[model samples]
Target: MEMRSLDRSTLGPENGFSQLLKPWPALNSPFKGAWCVVAPGTSTTRHAHPDYEIFIAMTGEATLSSEGEEITFRQGDIVHFPPHTDHQVINDGAEEFQMYAVWWDQETAGRFLERHDGQDGDRDGQEG
Candidate 1:
């Protein structure tokens, strides 16, 4: 597996996506897509992955949910989920939120918005 360390500067304030990691630049179809995500104390705008996903929290504590139920994850916790799993997270700890989210495709993102209250999550990062 080809692996590359993502520099910290690569992450910045993003629309909807607080932090982002473009592991797969789309040039390589069927790429192993991965992203670094960070959420503040407040809840993130609900979203989803069009493909299978894996979330790795780098630091701090967070509450992630896929329906009405929420699961709390401390530092070093890893979460594995399937495609179309509508989820959202918030960092409750007194620090910046950080997590690496891995997904398979752009369609997976749409499933996130579908689970929401009919709110379309067609933001910039994924499909428009």
Candidate 2:
């Protein structure tokens, strides 16, 4: 049983957001977890993992786009993404968006979503 507090000082910005990854090199955990901080007007790329992903809002609000559907969620709300489904989250609010995220089957999930967004950018739930 390993236990530790979230150290915000260790969080780093990446892909338009600041995140605290919990899976350390020697942790040997089957899942990957993170505390994500999405800056206002920023959005995460439309991406998918081979395993299930979960997100719990910790602060602010954002619009989540899964497949072609969109919904707004705020602090305290929980969101779940089915395996291998594409999704994107955008923070349109004036304040920074924050969430606690967890991905099951870290190995498979990492292999599947290794690539970041391409030229298309964040999926806008639009059909071309």
Candidate 3:
């Protein structure tokens, strides 16, 4: 077993967003977790990735835009997006918007998406 501390985590600031405690570029893992801070009145550019991603708001609020829809997410709300799904988060609040963001490889992500998508097939060919 291993233990880590959030206070010792690293901060990466880029393109109007800052990611704290990313496991990569230092540690190795199929999944990575980060505490993302979006500065007030700032926004992230529309982008897509090959990994499944999720964001859970921990403080303040933000507006998420994707697929022609915009939704406001408050503290304690969660958002999930599949691979290659273009999305952007805008911090339009008066305070910094903080959230927990997680990403994993496509294979691991496939399981979650498949289950929710009502797919009956599994990697072992078992029926759900």
lDDT on C-alpha atoms for all candidate structures: 0.61, 0.74, 0.75
TM per candidate? 0.59, 0.69, 0.68
Question: How many residue pairs clash in each candidate at the backbone level?
Answer: 5, 0, 0
Candidate 2 pairs with clashing backbones:
none
lDDT of 3: 0.75
Residue pairs in collision within model 3 = none
Expressed as tens digits, the lDDT of each residue in 9-127 for candidate 3 is 34455534555565433344556677777778888778888988898999898999988899998899999999898888898889988888888986755655655444445545766
RMSD of 1: 11.4
How does residue 50 of candidate 3 score in lDDT? 90
lDDT of 2: 0.74
* Ranking of all predicted structures according to TM-score, beginning with the best and ending with the worst: 2, 3, 1
Question: Over 4 Å off in model 1, which ranges?
Answer: 1-19, 23-39, 105-128
Off by over 4 Å in 2: 1-18, 25-28, 106-128
Clashing pairs in 1: 48-112, 49-108, 50-107, 50-108, 50-109
Tell how far residue 47 is off in model 2, in angstroms: 1.1
